[model samples]
Target: MTTPTDFLLWVRGPGFDIALVVFILGVIIRLLEVLVLGRKHDYSEPRGGELGPGLKTVVTRTLPETGSFKRAPFTVIGGYIWHIGFFISLFLFVPHIELINATLGLSWPGIASNLVDAVAAVTIVTLIAMLFSRLTHPVKRYLSGPEDYLTWLVTFLPMLTGYLAYHRMIDPYPLVLGLHILSVEVLMIVFPFTKLMHAFTFFIARWYNGAMSGRRGVQS
Candidate 1:
């Protein structure tokens, strides 16, 4: 039988490498598809400039409009909490920072592990709540499909496994750690093909829409 050590080694080595390759290649191919499908040439005369409006929209779109917030207070607030908590847990954790530094030759100071733990716990709760909301809300439930739920599962697993690993809630440290790494690998592998691609494409889309509107002298 394979030992926990073996499982850990495989995940850290071959498993991570495979996931990384798929993540990179998939992202590149998808991005190329989008970029290659260049928009139709606009013959209309430009009233202003595309660059300024595009940049402005990119910044403004980070927050919901007042009307949107009023309409979906839980979504807007919960989304903010999830994003903030996820970022803090991902970036400010010491082990994650060290891993990033080793992999990418980038380094940054990390916050307290306890703080990261708190954030991770909050993020996990927020994700669960979001899933519940999606399941119950008429419009969201109507639009939901397999990919949406799969995306949520893949996204949730990494955090849940990582938290469990950190707390050593599972038996055998190596096994738990291996599971955490594998969960992250799963997340990476599915990211480019799923709704998670919005992490990258959302900004590009917002900019494109804003730029077109700006060219027409309309505030996006």
Candidate 2:
């Protein structure tokens, strides 16, 4: 008979090893792309043909007045909540924490089980809402391509499966866990080539914006 121990072994051994390798390779490829092929723009001047005012303008005046935030607040908020919750669940979930404690001798602060459950639920819901918004919103609909929707599907499935595994619903816990791991493996395999690449590029873009504003004597 299949036991919890058996399932745990599969996850911690081959499943984890494969996931780790894929994650590492995906990150390396994404970084290489950014380093080698990413776009280069001179943001030294503002959108208008001027020196973008000054550092004060870049820092306080121009940047804050930018309408991008108001254009898509739902996407922004959903993205933030989903990401934060996913990372928290990944690093702090009990089983994962136990694994880390065993393999790496690292200990993280433990959260109550109920709180963890709540976080996972919120993450999944927000992600779903974001997906729905993408489908229904006119602007998002206009902008989204097949790859965009596919990326969201790929990203959302693992989270949903993982949460199901945690709750031990439907299939046996072991099977659900395996499926979760597999979904994540698929995501890792496709990370560098998909819209998911934003995970790696977002920070770079933010930094570039900040730097350009600084150089131009504008407030960001």
Candidate 3:
């Protein structure tokens, strides 16, 4: 008979192994394709330095520009809150910190559980609000399609499952916990192939834009 403990063990062992393998290999392949698939010669004379602006933009774009913030204050502000909260919960929560310590032999002090829980809830709320805005806003609605919604759900599910598991909201706690871990595995497998690549490509795209614009004597 399949027990909750068995389910949890499989998720933590084989499921995790599969997810990590796929995530890492897929990411590497995708990166190689992006970086190696295209090349061109730009013979135009330089009007300004490229490296400085490239580095600058990599840092600067993390904060919304004045015009962007003015145009989308809610998005800009909400994005910051969501990002900060999500990262804090992911990195600083006790369980996650302990997992890192166990797996990688690195350790750090985690924040209080209550604080992390509060941040997680807030980030989840922000994500929901952002999704609602996307659905309601005319421009965003027009631009978004099924993939956007699908990505949103997949991205959101791990957090939801993790929260539920942590709180033991359902019976068979081990099963629920396994579900959470499995949800994360699903996310990892899909991440490299989805818009989630933006987590990495954002820097490259910003740098290229900044460098090109700098060469054109414009600050981007």
Candidate 4:
């Protein structure tokens, strides 16, 4: 019989190490493939050119427009709310920050646990809202497949499990904690292989688009 202690050890030890290795190497490999796939040279003469405009475009995209909020209120609101909560819980939660501090020899002030809990609850709510939208909206529903929902679930599990464990909603504390760590490892392993790659590729893709448009002499 596997004791809770053994399960916890596995999750925190080899399981985590394997997940980290796979996550790092997979990200590196995928990133290299994208970078080395070199684009065709654009030989056209420019009417105007400023890399600044491209950079501006990249920066601007980070902030959604009021028009977009009006157009897709739920999506815009849910997106911002979820991301805010996600980051707060991921980085500011006491345990998570402590883990990072221990691992990287870096540290930041952690927020109050109550605040982290609230943010995590918000994250769960927003994620559910987003998932519901995906299931009900015609365009999103049509565009989505198993992989899309799978990625969403994979992304959602660690948050949900952590929330449960934090509150002791689950009886066996060790098992729940182990499950939470396992979910994170699962997410790391699945990350590069799924649409979740957006976590990393989004920046590169945006930079390329911005640079190309900037070189074209058009204000992006």
Best by TM-score: 1
Which ranges in model 3 have alpha carbons more than 4 Å from their true place?
Answer: none
Q: For candidate 4, give the lDDT.
A: 0.88
C-alpha RMSD for every candidate = 0.9, 5.5, 1.6, 1.6
Ranking by TM-score: 1, 4, 3, 2
Candidate 1 shows a clash count of 0
Query: Between the candidate structures 1 and 2, which one is better when assessed by lDDT?
Result: 1
What C-alpha lDDT does candidate 3 achieve relative to the native structure? Answer: 0.89
Task: Summing lDDT over every window of 10 consecutive residues in candidate 2, give the lowest-scoring window.
Answer: 48-57
TM-score per candidate: 0.98, 0.74, 0.93, 0.93
Q: Per-residue lDDT tens digits of candidate 1, residues 1-220?
A: 2899999999999999999999999998999999999989999899989999998999999989999899999999999999899889888999999999999999999999998998999999999999999999999999999999999899899999999999999999999999999999999999999989999998899999899999999989
Model with the higher lDDT, candidate 1 or 4: 1
Cα lDDT tens digits for candidate 2, 1-220: 2875576677657877887787788888778877888566764454432233332333453232337569767776787799889888888788778868998999888777778889999999998899889889988899999998888888888878887887888466767887787787778777777878877766566666665656666555
Q: Please tell me which predicted candidate would have the highest lDDT against the true structure.
A: 1
Every candidate's lDDT = 0.94, 0.74, 0.89, 0.88
Task: State the displacement of the C-alpha of residue 121, model 1, in Å, after optimal TM-score superposition.
Answer: 0.8
TM-score for predicted model 2 compared with the true structure: 0.74
Q: Provide the lDDT at 62 for model 2.
A: 22
